[model samples]
Target: IVLDRSGSMAFAHDEVAKNGSPAAAPPGWKMGHAVPKDARWLDTVAAVNGFLDIMDDSSHDERVSLSTYSDKSKADVKLTSDYTEIRAAMNTHSRKFKGGATNIGSGILAGGKTLGDKELARSWASRVLIVMSDGIHNTGTEPVPAAQQVANEQIMIFTVTFSDEANIQEMEKVAVSGGGQHFHAKDSQQLAEAFRKIAKSLPTLITF
Candidate 1:
């Protein structure tokens, strides 16, 4: 999965209820509450973890990798078949960083390279790329061209737009160009459900 670590993700959304709180309110609130800044990052992590938890273990042949992007991009973890190692790497590598630009193009390219590096050992029937972002393509090489490059390499590019601030039309075009799905998630619940949808669709692709 490719996560956008851009600064705009700090924007708040509505909160959900738990514990003895009223079904509509979060804590000391009315019918609704916005997500606190302190809680957004953890909510993202939990959403990712929830998706990982539901993935079917039967597909042992497949390998998964992760990448995050902001002002620049880097590979958090390379493609690996070992779930334990991936989980550990995710815990260690997925840090909260506040950067100005969103280098989503570079992020996708990095993910493609990571997957390509493992292509010799693991032949994937379908290569999947999941990108989650909350803002427009303000910096880096234009996203569409980069996305096209990845598409030419036969990688499916799934995208999740987390905020209205993002150019959803362009993101959706990227997904269509790469033969992947596009999701719009404005809050924690929508984000979690989006991840679940991605997990459920994983089986449709045959991993070599």
Candidate 2:
């Protein structure tokens, strides 16, 4: 799972509840973003943990690596089935730098490297890369071309725009280039449902 940890993500997703918002809201708020300045990273992390839950409920059994980017990209967890590791990484990362320009290209490149041939050699194992962001790529390399390269390798890329600040057009390009779909979620409900759909879309193991 590729996550965006830039400072802009600290902005409040205070929009009203919608039709398909995440079934579970964060502890405090009934519906909306639950992030304080010092606790600014909770909004995205809450949705992500929910996404992780959906994955756990699914039939697929595979380790998921997390790649986060702001001004630069970093791999938090190598490949691990332990959901706790991903959560720990998020909790630890929340305390890190929360300000920087969004460098989406860096995130994509890191994800590709982390999940390249060595990490994903099973031909039968369908590969998918999910890129979520709340803003446009304003730093580092261009993400479109990088996404194209990953697509060339047959890795499906699903792009998500979680806020109105995100560049829908560019994210759409990335999804199309990577041979996948683009999703937009202005509020928590839509965000939760987006993850649920992605989980459902993953390649499932068939039994004879």
Candidate 3:
């Protein structure tokens, strides 16, 4: 999974009822009198955790890696079946994921490199790289060319655009070049559902 840790991710999502508060709105107020907006990072984390849970329930053996990009890219996890490790990296306050330019292409390249390294050792596994971004690519390598290069190696790349501010058209082109699909998420619920769909679609491609 490639995640965007750009500064814009610190922006807020639609308001939701706070913990311990009733889910249903009172009478006139939406979400029970305008609670604080959930940060995009928080919602992304929750959606990712939900995705991990669904993947864990699958019968096929699957391994996942994590890559985050801002002004640069770093592979946080490398092809592990231990989902908790991925969860912890997002949940913990150890690494503050804030402030940086959105380098979407760098993230994709990092993910492709990680998958390529593992492919040499595990040729039997079907590799898929899922890249999620909440902002436009302003620095680093060009995403479409990078994605095409990876696709030429027979690795599928899925692109996901989160929030209205995301560049859906550009990401859709990336997905097409990479021989995969693109998903757009307008809100938190849709984000979770998008992950669900991606996870559920993998079993067919997975080889034992």
Candidate 4:
């Protein structure tokens, strides 16, 4: 899964006190970036963990990798069948990287590389890039070209707009360009449901 960890993603419902804005944050925290106090970020992480848990329960023989991006892309979890390891890699976001900008194109490139790893490409029957984002891009290269490049290599990409404020049209275009589907989640519950549905490749966006 490719997740966005940009500044825009770190917004609290009840603002706390971050860089003049009321938002809770770690000690000595600076402005221009998000801290752990973001409700939306918490929701995204919870939904992702839930997704991993569901995958573990299914016990499907699948190798999954994780990529997170904000001004740059980091492949935290290389392709592995161990869901627990993936979860651990995800949890390290407590010490998140500098994310004043959203480099979605970098995320796509990194994920595509992970899937296209020669050793993996030979064994894996399918490759899919699932990118979840809650904000529009502010920095980094335009996302479409990189997305197109990844798509050309046959890595289908599913773009998830994590909130109503998300750029649905851009994500939809990304999905179309990458030969995958687009999904929108208005709340935490819907986000969880979307993840579950994606796991099963179901047609509907809702689970219940």
| Model 4 TM-score, all chains together | 0.84
RMSD for all candidates, in order, please: 7.1, 7.0, 7.2, 4.1
Candidate with the larger lDDT of 1 and 4? 4
Off by more than 4 A, model 4: 13-34, 121-124, 202-208
Can you write out model 2's per-residue Cα lDDT over 1-208, one digit (the tens) per residue?
A: 7888776665556532233322333444321243344222466677778878877776767667889998999988776677889998987765553456789988987887766747544566667888888887989979899899887777889888887778999999998888888899877678877877777766641110
* TM-score, one value per model: 0.78, 0.82, 0.84, 0.84
Question: Clash number for model 1?
Answer: 0
lDDT of 4 by residue, 4-119 (tens): 87765666533431334325566666544445565566778888888777767664566789988988889988888877877777666645535457788888899889988776
lDDT of 1 by residue, 93-176 (tens): 334234346788888888777767754336635788888777777788777888899888878888888755667898898888
User: lDDT of candidate 2?
Assistant: 0.73
Which predicted model would earn the best TM-score? Answer: 4
Error of 4 at 186 (Å): 1.9
Arrange candidates by TM-score, descending.
4, 3, 2, 1
Question: Which 10-residue window of candidate 1 scores lowest in summed lDDT?
Answer: 16-25
Deviation of model 1 at 103, angstroms: 1.4
- List residue ranges in candidate 2 displaced over 4 A: 14-40, 117-123, 204-208
The true-versus-predicted C-alpha distance at residue 73 of model 2, in Å, is: 0.5
lDDT of each: 0.68, 0.73, 0.76, 0.75
